[model samples]
Target: MAANGKSRNLESFVKQQLEGAQKRFGDLEQEAGKVFRTLKARSKGQAREVEKLLGQINSDALLENPKVKEFGRKATQVSTDLRKRLDGLQTKAVEAVGVASQAQVKELNRELSRLSKKLDQLLPASVKKVTSRGSRVSAS
Candidate 1:
């Protein structure tokens, strides 16, 4: 009879623990759902704002405003200036590193090819035959 009472107490304890865990998980799920809905609502509102702004940008009234036109001009000028500065910095960095720029490399390749062709033309027929027999021949 004592063993039977102890068994009943253990079962009751396990059942209470399971019920507590289920309640906690349910509360967490409800909180997560509420957060997701709030974010979705805010995202929809922002999307509407973006659409309205796009419509305004395309409107003739906004485009014709002097302030807007001035802003556009300033923006273009800033972009151009930034590009020029970047190009200058890139050129300086390339020169400092002693590495050939693209243009210089291209010119060098063209010159090398021309010289190779000239050397091949100048070499005697006998030299080409010797080159094929395992000995390398190169024009100075």
Candidate 2:
């Protein structure tokens, strides 16, 4: 009897914990999506600005001027560096989300293991009670 009660309680606890984990995972996934979208939009805007600068250089009458060429080169390098940084940040964000997901899974497993142990400890007494009660009822 005690074993049955303990098993039921453990089952309930496991279910509750899993539900909470699912909620947390969902939230993290949504947040990651948001971060990706934000980064993409920012990258697109920067790319557009770089394109416009290049187009301006092409239109300028001083396109052959040394200073103008140097400025254009510097602008290109800056844009390239910005792109690399953004790419790094995006990669890091993805890795962080993955780590978070793994951690949540580990936590859920630990909780489940603890609950199972507790149920195991309670089971013998529960069975004994149920068997005794059944015998008494039959005798009566």
Give per-model TM-scores. Answer: 0.37, 0.40
Clashing pairs in 2: 1-126, 1-127, 2-126, 3-123, 3-126
Q: Tell me how far the alpha carbon of residue 133 in candidate 2 is from the true structure, in angstroms, after superposition.
A: 27
Q: Per-residue lDDT tens digits of candidate 2, residues 1-140?
A: 66667668877976786677577668877987998899999999999998888787755567878998999899999999999998997667646544335676699789878976786675555333335445522222
TM-score of 1: 0.37
Give the Å error, residue 36, model 2: 1.4
- Where does candidate 1 stray beyond 4 Å? 1-59, 102-130, 137-140
Q: List the residue pairs that clash in candidate 1.
A: none
